[model samples]
Target: MAHLSLSWANVAIVLSLCLGSISYGYDFSIISTTVGQPTWYAYMGLTTDPTQASLYSYSNSIIGTIFGLFSAGAIFGGLFVGWFSDAHGRKKSLLSAAVINIVGGALQAGSVHVGMFIVARFITGFAAAMLVALVPVYIAEVAPPAIRGLLVGQHGAFFLVGYTVAAWVAVGSFYSANASFNWRFPLSLQALWPLLLCFFVYWLPESPRWLVSKGRPDEAWKILAKLHYDPKDPEQLFAREEFFQITSQCAADKASYGDVSLLHLFTKPHLRKRTLVATLVMWASPANGAIVIYSNIVVLVAGLGFDSADSLLLSAGWITLACVGNFANAFYLDKLGRVRSMVIGYVGCIVFVIIEAAIVAEYGGTTNKAALSAGVAMLFGFITFYGGFVDTTIYVYCSEIFPTHVRAKGMGWSIAVFFLGNLPFLESSTTGYATIGWKYYLLFIILPALNVGLLIYFCPETKGLSLEEINGIFEDKVAVRLTNLTEEERRDLDSRILDGVVGKDPQAQAPERNNVEKSAEVTLDE
Candidate 1:
């Protein structure tokens, strides 16, 4: 193994994981276009009158229910992936997700009945669930602590980019007028993305930390050498040390292959706090009503009296703005601590949503274009704030909050809550839109306020911590002294600390003794 900068390898992993996000984005956005199509209702055998439309729109709920179900599958998949990656490796789990993607995409695109489509979407959702749950874990695992935020943040950034592309495609397909082929083309195209990803993923290396955990010290060193550390240098010594820290934490927590019981998540103190934070973050992101608003933008705008083309364009513009916000977030997330970003975002969402509700209440059913424009602008503002902060930060925060042992399970469980929140809107846009009317925006307002409280109360700062140090935060054992270290010092401590936990080999006892001595000294001093 020769010393290589793992930076390139990390980028490779990001690119591969992004394929799954593309599928997620595509599925979510495709519905917006499909909902607008006359043919879609015809195929589903439904009418489009506002009252009748509510029934037709119940299909959205059906889709959402399936989405939630698949998310349930994903919770399992994510939990399994954690142990599987620890046992079989990250690359293999990714390969497994790709296979699910291919099959699910095929079934969805070719469906002749709603049942088949539902089943296909459910499977695809499961695949997406796993991708969302695992990809961040993979990126966090492979990244240098210096750039972990930037790398993990890229997942959300790219996810928004994927959403932008989906919006563009939706708008194009809406205008294409090839009634026979319009929506299907965009849905089917998503299938090719995961297939292409499979080819590229082969070039990427396995996670170096994972290699060490599996007791392959030489192979781990080889990977570390390629990641820009000298094979024979003491850094490999340091790398081994960091690996043990994670393993020891897993053991102390009783985390193991097949140990990912959902009951354990609630019963274990350390795991429970992690689960709480992750679930709240994930729940907060979708509960703001952004997904509902975006998914049904056409109907929302139409209800406000905008023309169909104009509504689609507005949706496109909002998505474009969201992309910009996502980009800005990716660049600055490391600078802004996760809790701060989320708090600011929730505040912004509350204000904007209230304003949108006000505008709609004042003139939603009127013929005044200016009143309608104000409503639209308010909607855009809500999306802008959402994209800027909550959208991007949620994933980064969720992944960072959990220990590596149950990271996947934690993420999966939280995301399942997110999709479960999605289930209501699918049944009837009216469920939210009619029940609240323009006041529907108010529902979003209240949730973010709750999120703001949760973030301030429960969430901890995680701006510059290494993965191991992050675990220490959850355990409440990350010392204040450790927090004062320079970035370089922190990295060195993380590497040295972890090596002591996992040891150089299973039979090696020297590093474990060293860790015990160091831990005692640190504890006594504190």
Candidate 2:
């Protein structure tokens, strides 16, 4: 057997997977501009007073309700995406999301009424949910084990880039004299990204693991040859040991396509813990009130006394800062243990939220420009900490928590719960702000504290470990001791596990199965 290096073909496959993240990011941020247009309010016949003749008035409650509904749709979409991706494959699921994006974007851009617009937003939100749920899974599967953290971290970086682009686009559209139709252009333009993804994804290969699971060893070998080894090498000779190990593991766990049922997620031992860890990590991801703030920073800024134009500019700036922060996170994720990075981020967010709360309490919507600027600064601080750490870690953590058999489903469940936590805040933003005033920052502060506590107790370190090693961590007895392994041992383990090559020695197989069962029992007990 000949040794194969992780080659350019592998890098190309990873890049192609990363594009799905870009699509997810682009779709998520495009709405910020469109929702703020004057025509949107005018079409709804909005007024300051709810008692007036307007359909929805410029009431915070109405806006919050709209945002909340979108979140709800996303929760449903996330839930649905898991089954879809499992049944249809990641590429096909992504293509489905792209189609939804096109339809939703078109409807939203050309909407003639508030009802139509809200419904369109829901449709778009559903598509965004699918993207969020599946993109990380795709990236994780395709990435080289050595760079999985970095590549998975790139999802957040790309998401912030999408957000930054939307911010600038919003600013430009608002500044244009023909702002009415220009806002529509930003929303409409999102359609192009998904269309591009749909075209390009067809050129990419199916997940090699997925092929192995389905017993198509020849196809899986061909893919591995193209992706990691030289195709001209003797068939099954290069990486034969590694490939045999991987295939053996897959054969041990083999099940038909029909056996990939959601019930298995709960009933199967290996899968149950995976589902729990994925859920917790995802629940922690957006639970810090970051998504609420991201979606409604315009309003939050107005509460700080900035005029609409300045608020938009400030929002744009914050998002740009966040994009930079996300890039920094991508650079550091592998060096910083996932658990540590996430903890540090949550701690920082807690401090910033407290400061922001104080600023809001001191100013109390007082129209004092200095006070408002201070509030904006604090908010920007919050964004910086969030994007740099929490945002990036969530996707990486989710990607690492599950084994190949249930990775997509685990991710989908996590995203669905994330959206569920997000929905209430998105809907009640106006009520939360109006009733609590500047004290609304309390909500953000509280969640991160809870998040930090959860991490301390539940989350585990995943730095410098192979997928199989990480999988072993959920078991009570495996000890998760990667620090003891030599570099060669680590590489060999990763290659063997990923290529489905595990020895049939009872000593090895017994411990692994015992670990899987123990992990499942622990998760159920939790």
Candidate 3:
């Protein structure tokens, strides 16, 4: 329980990182509400059929392109994260992404034509995707090992907070008489997050792990010391030994890597397995086709005989439930571990999505409130499971599994695959929902069933391991951790362990000599 406690430093780092997540959530959810608004359609100059009750008549293809192109831009952004974060470092990368988002948000708020709006969305999507990749890596690197998974999972919780805010803003703006200003205000608000990030992020400490990777151990040790223990406390000894281990591991890893390249991920056996696992988890993210369903939720609701405003409002509730689910996930992920919790969510999504599709196919065209209410409930249930497990755990697994030398690249490629997987769903969602209807959801149901199987078989459990310790899994050694030690005992053991491992003092290794020799032999055999 003591290991799980959050210090002020931990809270500060986590809250600061959440700015990027909030920014992404706001932009992602606002569109669902905005696109359904009369003011938004009127401002965009979409044509309407005179006899139709709804004023907007944009084709499904047009809507799909508008949404899908954002996914396209995100793919480009994710591709850039590996090089950018590796070359410029994490802080600079995040600062650069903030500037890009500000420019895009400004353009989107002021867009006067469809083309301008489309371009702005692409730019914003690109920025958002980079932030998505950057924030988790930063958090994963800085977090204390005991709570690393919990902190990494916060990305989704905070993102859902932003989603909830956007939904309410869109609903509030529905009554505005000024069509242009109604949609404009929500888009403009996207600037607030990045602005906050840019101004405050500099005050935070750079990742000590990154400092170690760059051969600056003095700075790395100082930062790690400040983050973990009081100057006079016995716990400082553990922090010092931890620094020694990190530097040793980084030097070894650097030698092993030689010249790092993207191809090396596929060519190297252990890294390749790690890469494959990361990629599959990301591919599983959209296995339920949740993103496609969410993007078109407002429109889909309207098509079910609900009014536009009501549809937007109902969509808001779905996001609120998602926020709750995400928070619940952050609480339980460490306890349940990554794979089991995610499987629970996927299983729930599989059941609810099937039920929802059947309801929509049979009763979507009519005005049966009971059926429609049940359908909405099922969609909410799907998101509850999705936001709780898949949204957060996928990023956690991707971030924790990669070595520090290639972490950004590993996560970057995973996110690229994430956006890539979404492309087909995004491109087809609008048209599929209109033409094939709920049968489109059959693809979603089938894919997640398969994904659940893959997750059970392939996904590794990574709840409590340090970033460096995870390497043991690929090398076929058991994970070693000090989490079970009382703080006082850990402080005492750290001194002796450091003497044996770093000082080569055989006397200090007496207590665990046999265990250490066995582990070494196994590691060497690989």
Candidate 4:
């Protein structure tokens, strides 16, 4: 839709859907914090002082195992959800995740042993992974192309809202007189978000694209118009055009590939390339090396020579700042376009990481206050830029890259790889900071440097185009991207397709369509 204004109804829909993200975020922050509680250590027969968690060998084993198990669970969860979301439908998949998380959260809160708690963590990871991977697909399907970035980017911002809240609440529990309350109370809070989602999820609209794929075009048309309705444009021309685009493209997609199968993601030449780009981009999203900082922010803050009392407060504030940065990203993202925003993120990551390595290498062991201060500022800068540019853009970019038929499966694989991308940086120990020092930062620079090259040649601009329009770009069905064209140009292109598309049998055009189309790779320059 050209020059569309966001309706209040659409904004409400976006906000309501973000509860799943908030749950995913809260679970993420709560896990990292609850693992550090004194009672948690006691339960595991380890040191009460979490600061010594690393110093103690058994504590290191369990803590590392916990993180590893969570990653494993998340990977499997991603693979499962792709098939589930596509087969059942988007809203059902979301609700299933919420229900699963409710069970996982309760398991986590009331665990009687370390094994149960470990199981609980795995379950929570499974459900949380589904939530994150699926939310963007549903939102992208329904969001107006004009503000698609701004709408879909809310997943990043809202999850961080949960992250920020979990941070402050963990701080509150840390100071509580009751020891078990420190871990149990915060872990129990995980149930709250999914419970909220379960209560309100019925209000959400199903993805119109999914409906069309299911042979429900009349329903899809009504929902699409409602989603993109502009009161000023009473005729809803954009909405009608958008519905036409999705249905026709999906018709062609069905003709090209008989049914949705995981094998198609690997076997189809065009799909294989998309899957590769999505996977690499997802990998690149976490390769920026901010995981080291996020997992150790309180320690990093404390190391800046601040009093212990203020470290947690400052950590919470930093996450909140990152949350704000995500909101800023939501707004600026469409204006910059997905590929450029990601490149800016990669280039910025390389720049700040280099500066950070230099600062730490120069004065890491020294009590030189100015140098310490500069190093701390650089860490904050790196995270803020990464959160705004890279972290926030991953979902928006990946969700739009595939056609409606395979988007869920594509995202599942992408998010699964995303979990793997994070593994290399989970060093979670200051041993690297102290033993390897600045050289550890140097390790992170390589992938993002490689990523900028991958992005320039592999990723294309998807901003300001409908989801079906983007599929056309990948298939080489259009010579010029509609996003870069004038209204007249789009009208001309639409008129040709509209003749065969509007109120006609899609199969009738299949033979002629097959003769002209090519499944070539698309790039920024192409």
Instruction: Using lDDT, give the best candidate's number.
Output: 3
The best-first sequence of candidates by lDDT reads: 3, 4, 2, 1
| Winning candidate number (TM-score) | 3
**Predicted candidate 2 versus true structure: per-residue lDDT over 1-526, tens digit per residue:** 1343466876666566555566666666665544555655665665434456344435555676667767777888888888888777877898898899789888877887777877987888798888877777877765555577787787788878778888888888887777456677777777877787788778888876666555455666566556656556543333443344445444434321124566787887767776766677777766687887888787678667767788788888988999999989878988888888888888888898898888888886686788778888888888888888878888888876776666777787788888888877777766677677767778778877887888878777877665545656776223233335676876776555445433322224434443543454455556
Model 1 lDDT per residue over 104-210, tens place: 77886787877777777777777776677667777877666656777887777777776778777777877776764666776776677678767866877777656
Lowest-sum lDDT 10-residue window in model 1: 249-258
For every candidate, C-alpha RMSD to the true structure in Å: 5.4, 6.0, 5.3, 5.3
CA lDDT, every prediction? Answer: 0.68, 0.71, 0.79, 0.77
**Clash count (model 3, backbone only):** 0
Candidate 3, after superposition: displacement of residue 263 in Å? 2.1
User: Candidate 2: misplaced stretches above 4 Å?
Assistant: 1-6, 47-58, 230-242, 255-260, 476-526
Q: Write the per-residue lDDT of candidate 3 for residues 1-526, one digit (tens) a residue.
A: 1244356786788899899999988877777776777776666766423355243235445567778777888889887978889887888989988899898889889998878988988998899889889999999987777687789889878988888998889888877887776889988998999999998789878887787676566667667666776544554554655565566566566656644677788999889999999988999887678787677778777777788788988898888888888888987888889889889989999999989999999998888989988998888889988988777888888988988888998988888898889888888886677668889889988899998899899878877777887887777232234545677877666656555553433223323433443444456556
User: How badly does each model clash, as a count of residue pairs?
Assistant: 19, 8, 0, 0
**Shift in Å, residue 121, candidate 2:** 1.5
Indicate whether candidate 2 or candidate 3 has the larger TM-score: 3
Ranking by TM-score: 3, 4, 2, 1
Could you tell me which 10 consecutive residues in candidate 4 have the lowest summed lDDT? 516-525
**Model 1 bad stretches (over 4 Å):** 1-6, 51-87, 229-260, 476-526
Model 3: pairs clashing at backbone N, Cα or C within 3 Å: none
